[model samples]
Target: MDSEKELSGKTVLLMAIATGIIVANLNYIQPIEGLIADSFQVSKAAVGVVAMLTQLGYAFGLLFIVPLGDIFNRYHLIQIMLSLSILSLLLAFWAPSLIIFGVASLLVGITSVAPQIIIPYAAYLAPSLHRGKVLGNVLSGLLTGILLSRSVSGLLGSVLSWQYVYLIAAIACTILLGVLHLYLPRDPRQKQHMQYGKVMASLPKLLAKEKHLQGSAINGFCLFGVSNVLWSTLAFYLAHQYHFGSGVAGLLGLLGITGVLFASIIGQMVDKYSPRMTVGLGILFSTLSFVIFTSLGHLFIGLIVGIVLLDLGTQFGQVSNQAIVQSLSLQASSRNNSIFMFSYFLGGSLGTFFGTLAWSNFGWSGVCLVGTIFLVLALLGHLFLKEPEKLQKVS
Candidate 1:
């Protein structure tokens, strides 16, 4: 495989599809928690544990597994991860107990870091001028999978057993693994010589040294936490307020396509302008979205409009932050991405925990209040944080 081979449109499209499929594994359980609870005769709070465990696993993978991309052949690494995903999905499909299913969910989450690898790989493949656009397109696939997986899961759960969802995903993963094995070129870069322990040691050093990386990680943490608060409890809110089931609740994701639509445009903006400027605009849009939801979430039309702004705003903020973070070091893009995502998903885990607690105690309003707090913190952090002129001295 020629590392110098220019990326084609077809290659980009394949990366996008592969990313979507891999990411969907992390989210396919979200909308169908009710179904799983019913099957296991458990409380909704207990079902929330499933999602929490999955997120925890993802964070762990980001910290531990993604750094390997900087050292090993990424193509082989992806194949290994996809194969693990298939095994985990099979376990999820056939688990005899909720405990078994929960464990499988964790494994699925761990292996689902394939997209994290793919995103940076795409960045490497693309020319520097088009890097933002390429990353945005790939991330659009990622976000679409995160949002739409809910709908697909809900529909599958409605039409068949919830277990069937995992079963089907296993089959899909198998096919994707084959496609990737055939289509992906061998990674051409020489493997890094850093020992694994040294690699792990550098994460904290990087965070302490790179002020921009620190700020972006914190921003990612808060914004993702806010987003998770909404997604984690959306189904329960709809079910309680509107007498809707998982299927109807899941349909809200379709409205969230506003994010997908704006991703490439946001990428172009990143290329033409500063990431900081785009991030500021995104924060304003997201903050306005919360204002709408807080005041008018009870109204169905209001929910739709709020979701559109919320999705668009979050994607704008997220993509720009990524563009900046990925620029820190070309050689360490994978490691840099890992640190950022580890923080990002760590926030997600916290949000899921508290979001479920909020749902149990105070319901929709509580969820909104908590989510608002996260976003406000993110906005303030971005405003106050200063990027250092040269991180090389500290590094």
Candidate 2:
């Protein structure tokens, strides 16, 4: 049966729930940084190690793990990962120090492969005409879960303590594992995939051949670099400079979420019009939004307004960029997403790192400067020529 035909009562709920739970795992560390540090009797920098460990785990997982979807029984793989992720969460919850907690965070990060699975599943299930919009819908859920994780983590830490935050996430992980074991469909494609070695060796060859793919990857890279800076460091500015707390900073995430909704709408428009327009407009807002944030630093209402614009800019560009990449590859659909999203996450990781660096050096002003420069580069990356044509970046 077509997978669409299988989106029946239990299956739909199971998939949605599984997707949300797994995706939410990515952000569970943010809200409880202070508490986690106190537990270990370490400085805040020690907990920062957990964030890097998890991000590195995710980067390595995408390098090896997400690609496995093309060549394995994703159902079984997801189940195994979710089980291990639950164990990891429990480890994080009960850890005595930051070192042990960092190890647990690494395990949890590597195993939380839900969004990678969901994106490809959407690719497999949806037809071309509706793919962009459907992918946007799925991404909207993913982004919302990401934003809300901080808030939920805050509340969980507030009422019950931070350790309980991970425990609750463990419970969530267990529930998702059960649902996937019972309901997610197994793919026949697993048996048909090539040797894993060939798949692993092919990234260079793939990049060597596809100019459009490279452009798409670069687009994702530059665009997400800007977003990574804003979201990662804004909380520091709000907390230290403005004297805001976790509650208020978490609320500020809604600005990005609102931008995501607007971007989702723009993604649908990509299907109806020129993809170049989508890229152009998205870049425009990204640059402008950050400028406003920088220029109006002390004005609370202006910061809110700028963030809303900033997020809309980012979501629109990202969704459209994915659509562009996916449309270029017929046989390499999963591989296409692997490259595109790898660049997206890779860019985010680097962006966050650099944003932190800038925050350390130039303070909030420097952070916004880095963000604006990336946005301008993204915009200029589009300026030279074809959206429909490939970029000159690759040889």
Candidate 3:
């Protein structure tokens, strides 16, 4: 480990920007799903499969590819992944059939694991005392990319065609790939020469032995599921309820910046206080957001407030939970992060799937119910699960 080398602010910003740009590939199709449905002459519910498959592919990458970070040169691995990501984006841009597009989406998700790699690398480079704050700043960039991706895609899909969004994304990735090559430092840590099989096998053992990992993973699963439930069905709801288009749905994503603003602040709180406290606050804000959604979602202002709270709550829970998981072991940091992120994105996949199902069958009411159920499960895990003694004293 490069424990002695201090992480510079400029490098941290670079990593954050790299993560934001790379991760944006997985989200560009979300706001534009409705447009995609129209282009392919498919039902709104059927088009949702694209979103589900993308997240599932992300989960698959987290489990299989991210662990390689511990074994290989992460800088090389990231460059290779970003290179693959550009190919996938171009494939999506040129896809003629829905099936081909779905396949390209899956590939895009699989190759977009660079952000996960960068995150663990950042954690390793940062000082333990300020790790949470550093993570928060990086996460802010990531969250910003996620929010803006929807808006940009929505606007582009509104003006141009939906496929152009993917083309533009490909060009963006190509540019970022060059910038990272020029400025990003190579991994300074010595490589672990463990066989890939052994690295994969160790994941299950880590989950079984680490109570804190188990708790944090479950919290991540449910909390992220809650966030996806709302986001996955949001465009459909707007179209049905208010006669809105993909453009309006995309605009709503801008509201989530309100939550992104709090990411670093929440990270600082995790550093000074406890991950548990921030997690509880996250759950509280998420639960309240759902309450607003269920009761007052008919109003434009109500939806806006709910969106802000949902993002805020999700930011709090995600950053704090990650800090806890990353703190468990620096040597195993990549593997640890893979486990947490796998569960997290798995929840996202299922959430997108079920939220679409709920919207199809029971409308917005059903979507709210599904989100509530996820929150209830998250609360149970947060209140009942125990943290490690060392984690309780992060300061």
Candidate 4:
């Protein structure tokens, strides 16, 4: 055993590793959609099957894996999941067909428990006064992971085979896993309330009982819908419209990462002022991004500006959403986060599915429409959201 004494400095490093693990899995998959479709000799629509499966896998992980935090020793659970994540990524890399690729992606998604583990870990580490800040910083890494994964993958896809990308991630995960085992703080809690059937049964009642959590989750869903539309299809649109190669298209992801780089600022603001204010401002930025994109008329600068607004707005809303969801269910933070994140990814899957089709049909104009609608709906959800009793007490 390490020590009953705190791991101190290692917690942040552990959080970073956890964030990186999922980023390596999820974002890397975005730019390669077209490539994978071609590899499978399937229509673009079928690529959605892959996206859906990956998200479904994530939802499964959220439901089945995250709850263990409230029940088991998180230390052991994280190690097992991290190891499985490594094996899953390897299987994904060496898979024979797109069919196998999809399956591996699903498993990798399932085992990518990095975020679930780390968020709670952050909660466990910080004092209440600094809890939101710690979470924000850690989550910023997760968001960055989500952004850079696409950006880096797009930048690298043409130069190297996609399998090598997963291979690189596998190596990274292995190093991080070892580091975590060596240094991560031990869990303070034990497994107790893990009746899987009971947890599943309570979801509906939980949703009904916790309207605030539901609303926050809905808002997150819409926010992710906006982001996923762009990420899932932007490479195709940029390539098809302006005849730019993967490199420039990938650079757009960096432009959007501007938002992620600023998420901690939003977190700070959430601590200082109201989460609603940050969310409202984010909605405005998101709307501006969509409008600029539609009017860009294939000018490169227009694309750059669009990326900035979209990413910033998306992440701002996300940071606030995380704050709100975490506040709403102190007893069931993991479960609440799971539901909230699952909705967000579900919306992403829908955005990726329909957004890709819309792109093929109406081009950038179509994507702008999808993003605009989702952002608007998200804004509405945020506006209508009420803080639960526990959140108010925390505030």
**TM-score for each prediction?**
0.95, 0.88, 0.97, 0.92
lDDT tens digits by residue: candidate 4, 1-395: 23223434457656865785665686677777777777778876677667667766876787777766666677778888888988988998898888898899889878886687668656655555555566678777887777677777777776887677788888888988888787777776654666767766766677787877787778778877887888888778767877765666666777766765686787787777877777777778878878887887477788788778888888887777777777665556667777777787778778877788788788778888888889779777866775332334342
Q: Candidate 3 lDDT, tens digit per residue, 1-395?
A: 45435468888889989888888887887788888999999988887888999999999999999999999998899999999999999999999999999999999999999999999888888888888888998888888888889898888888999999999999999999999999887888776789999999999999998888998898889888988888888888888889888899889989989778888898898888778888888899999999999999999999999999998988898888888988888888889999999999999888899999999999999999999999999989987895443353231
Per-residue lDDT of 1-395 in model 1, one digit per residue for the tens?
Answer: 33236577778878888988988998888788888889989888888888988888999999999999888899999999999989999999998888999999899989899998988888777777777888889889888887878888877887899999999999998999999999985676776788889888999998887888888898888878877787788888888889888887678878778899888898888887778777777778778877887899999988888878878877987888788777777778888899999988888878887898889999888888888888888888888884332222111
Give the winner by TM-score. Answer: 3
The lDDT, on a scale of 0 to 1, for candidate 4 is 0.74
Q: Which of the two, 1 or 4, has more lDDT?
A: 1
Off by over 4 Å in 2: 1-17, 34-46, 188-190, 384-386, 389-395
Q: How many steric overlaps are in each model, in order?
A: 0, 1, 0, 1
Each model's lDDT comes to: 0.84, 0.69, 0.89, 0.74
Better candidate by lDDT, 2 or 4: 4
RMSD of 2: 3.8
Cand. 1 Cα-lDDT:
0.84
Candidate 3, which segments miss by more than 4 Å at Cα?
Answer: 1-6, 388-395
Estimate, for each residue in 292-381, the C-alpha lDDT of model 2 and write its tens digit.
Answer: 878886689878888777777777776777677667653565666777777766776667677767876788888888887787667666
Off by over 4 Å in 1: 1-4, 386-395
Ranking by lDDT: 3, 1, 4, 2
